[model samples]
Target: METVSVAIASIGRETLLDTLRSLAAVTRPAGVDLKVLVADDSKSGAATKLVTAHPIKSLDVTCLAVASGNISTARNALLNAADGGWLIFVDDDEWVEPDWLVKLFDCQKEFNADVVIGPVKPVYPDNTPDWLRRANPLYTDWGHRGKRLYTGRGGNTLVRVDFVRALKLRFDEAYGRTGGEDTIFFAQAAERGARIFATDDAIAREHVPQERLSMNFILSRAVRAGQSYGQMRLARHPDPLWHMVFALGALAKCGVAGSLALSFRLFDKARSFRMRQKLSLNMGKLRAVFGRPLAELYKKPD
Candidate 1:
């Protein structure tokens, strides 16, 4: 009978309702209690109305209206109100597996992990490009696989209330606009020596709108990666020379392999295609090295 408080900061009122419905659908194990807290950061009072309209049968949900658009601020507001032993965060636009919370709690207890990062797979209702699907693993960092020790999206993470409160960790408002607040928060935790564990059992499905499938959205998303890469490197290593060396070395390796792949078609088509794709990705990483500040991308309209 462990209690888990799920805190969600919602901006879009329509999406909030959908999230609430999803939470209501999750079936918890006996003796375990689930509490859902929604910090509404919408200008209009639509979120309040939507929460009241919905009849959630499974979990106890509280929707509080707050006049702010910053995700970190809204999340902090929820944290202040939550009373459960563990705090779970989810995006308003995403829904979780029925056993998501149960799996998370189990892993948290087993690993004694300060933070648990779960998988977030994009749920596309319609047709989606193969390349986009293939890029999922590349974009998401999890389980100590990448340079970023903690890489799960904010939507699929569970943190111990005491640890978070002790460290006074809050999502960085700087990344609030580009939606990298989760990244900054995890980085802070990692820096503070928090033990983060990645779990696939606690799964969530993020609904990707059709609009985000376009090339413009894909390319624009690149800016966030670049910004995160730059910030992460700067935070860890202050040496500018090493950063340049690392960037140049990565570009050179990709360039050599890319040129060879184009010159010789001896390898299988699938293998060759993958090499070409790698070349393109390496080029993108290089571009990110010189891209403008992270704040600049926040200026562009989504």
Candidate 2:
């Protein structure tokens, strides 16, 4: 099996190690090889000792201490370090299933895709709120019938190494902490007519901490979503109306969902769950419309 090198930009050693353990156990398919580059952005150099000690021989691991915080910048560092034909990305806080690499490779072969994106399921440590679970877009791919190209997701996706190299696609550092770097980067790929594909088979699960489930967290996340969308739209057109249109659409979806959730509190069922989900979405939309500071939104209780 020809080796397919994968460079993963990871921060926080402990979190990344969890992901590495999964990768270490992964059974490489026949005629396939795997290597990992951990772009360690932590100043502590935490991943150095951990990754070096792993017992997987086939897995050539390199942990670079990147003294920076941006995920996009870290990823670019990995792209520069890797010498593989295929590149796969996984977030430091997420773990891929043992068959993850194999399945991703299979999808790449099956579609001959330039970029392949798959599902990202959230793995909560303990019992999670229905709203949080319902709010997650994981466990689903929003693809049109016969559509090959898509807005690529950073986690749980694969890309042809040469294709990325040729296009010089890097997550835009301008997107920064609000985190549309992945979306903006993939948008550029899509614009260049890259053959993007999605499959349900390739899966990676991300852990959502309990802290992230609070209403404040939800609202803050929503604000970030607005900022991301605003940037995307502004990049395409100067019109504020388009932004408002998106904001209104979000609000409507949330209103419908919240209405249903509130109505169904008497009976715990799918509708109730959905209602809570929608309400969250609605609040997000309202934030988008008002263009309030994310910090201020977090101050008011939902």
Candidate 3:
């Protein structure tokens, strides 16, 4: 069996501790050599210290100090450092199911996939409103899994080390601070004929911190998502003139969505989320066109 490197890039935050602990306790699949490599992006080297302190015996866990704040750099650091035929990326804030590796590996072999994307469940905080929980305001819809070519979040995904290494794929550092580096990276991979598939059962849980529940956080996340989408579309468009026209259309959508949000925000929970997210996405695309300041969500608030 080939080696599998479970790579996690963290900012050395307190939440990172939980993620590491969970990874340490995960059940290792039989006949597979799996190891955990944590690439730390904190200037303080806090994540490295944390990994050293916990010291999981189930799997070999190692930490490396990488970028100060850039997620792409941190991820790339792990890519270069890890030795694995199969590479699995789990966000530093997520906890994997005990059999996550087994499931992901099984799916990849079953489909002969170059990449396997999995679902990341949300761990809602206590005292959350029932309406918000029902709405699922945090996670995006992955649409029932199939042999689909789609760009997705970094919360949970597996990649063939050969496909990426052969092509020398790296997450764009430019988009690191602003977010969307993962979108661009996977887009490039898909274009290179990488077989990206999804497994619904292989799950990891992402903790939605209290700050992520605020209206401000939701809006910011929506905007970043839109900005990433716009950039992705623009990158793939064949003609520059057509891309410009498409961008204009997206900007117009922002105005329309904003108006609808104002009109219906009082009457509906799901409708409000749908309308507001639409508005935020369009606004983000507009910002991408004019070079607006990015809403850096990963950074600690001042």
Candidate 4:
């Protein structure tokens, strides 16, 4: 029988139980042996302890102690531990629909895809600000169903294990702290002719904590995203001329966004916020081009 491993790299957040609970409730495909692997990156083995304390009776869940504060390292641990024909990745804070796994499998088979990505809907708290809710910057639109994508994210994604192993692909440890390892990994997979497809049916809902609702978090995340894009571009093209051209393009875009933000500052708050976000993203790209170090957003607290 074919094996499918649902992999999660977590730091023992309280919501992890909810994630496991949701997985336990999912409909397993016939003839597929489903397994859940959690790579715990905590020094105290918090996730392992939690799982031991609250075991889900229906699922065969195993928690691996990675003890690495780096998200990439944790994810790599999951990849190393997954012994299966296919692997599914989900965030520790996200809960999936009952048919999420089935839908992912169907999409992969339908498109003959090496990788399948699904959307992550945000669940905002009741106390969330109206403007922040209106903007909804956290929602990820992975294009229409069956649309081919050049790159994919780790969260709510399905991967053919053989393809990844054949390519000897592993999440880069260099991006462990600053995040975006998935972006780099998926971009490399695409470059190597991996077909990635999007599916809307495999839905996962991520709870947006109160801390993430601030403009500070939003702008910082945008910058990090831009930095990831810049890093990917540079890695793909090592030529100095290409780097220079890319930096110039980013600068031009940044200037345009900044100006638009200023123009809309008084009349359109939402548009201004969006333009500012764009400006910050381009600035991050420029920073990456210039080899400036970014803040380690994923660094574990001491």
lDDT of 3 by residue, 165-190 (tens): 99999998887777898988888898
User: Clashes per prediction?
Assistant: 0, 4, 0, 0
- Which digits, one per residue and each the tens of the lDDT, describe model 4 over residues 162-210? 9999999999888888878899999999999899999998999998898
Which tens-of-lDDT digit does each residue in 1-302 have in candidate 1?
A: 76778888775546666677777777776786889888878777556667777767766988877757677678888878878777889887778887887787777777778788887777764676564565442235465311124544577788878887889988777666666677667777878888788876787877777877665565456545545755565567668787797678658868875876576447444444445555554555565466545543332211
Instruction: In angstroms, give how far residue 11 of model 3 lies from its true place.
Output: 2.2
Model 3 off-target regions past 4 Å? 259-266, 290-293, 300-302
Candidate 2: where is the Cα deviation over 4 Å? 53-56, 129-149, 239-244, 269-276, 279-302
TM-score for each predicted model, relative to the true structure = 0.81, 0.81, 0.91, 0.95
- TM-score (C-alpha) between model 3 and the true structure: 0.91
lDDT accuracy of residue 19 in candidate 2: 81
CA lDDT of every candidate: 0.69, 0.67, 0.80, 0.90
Sum up the clashes in candidate 1: 0
Among these predictions, the greatest lDDT belongs to: 4
- Candidate 1 deviant stretches above 4 angstroms: 29-31, 129-148, 253-291, 295-302
TM-score of candidate 4 against the unseen true structure: 0.95
- The better-scoring model by TM-score among 3 and 4 is 4
Tens-place lDDT per residue, model 2, 122-236, is 7765687565465553334546323576476678778787888888888876554456677778878887878888877667787777777666665455556555554555466
In candidate 3, position 131 carries an lDDT of 71
Give the C-alpha miss distance for residue 192 in model 3, angstroms.
1.2
The candidate that achieves the highest TM-score relative to the unseen native structure? 4
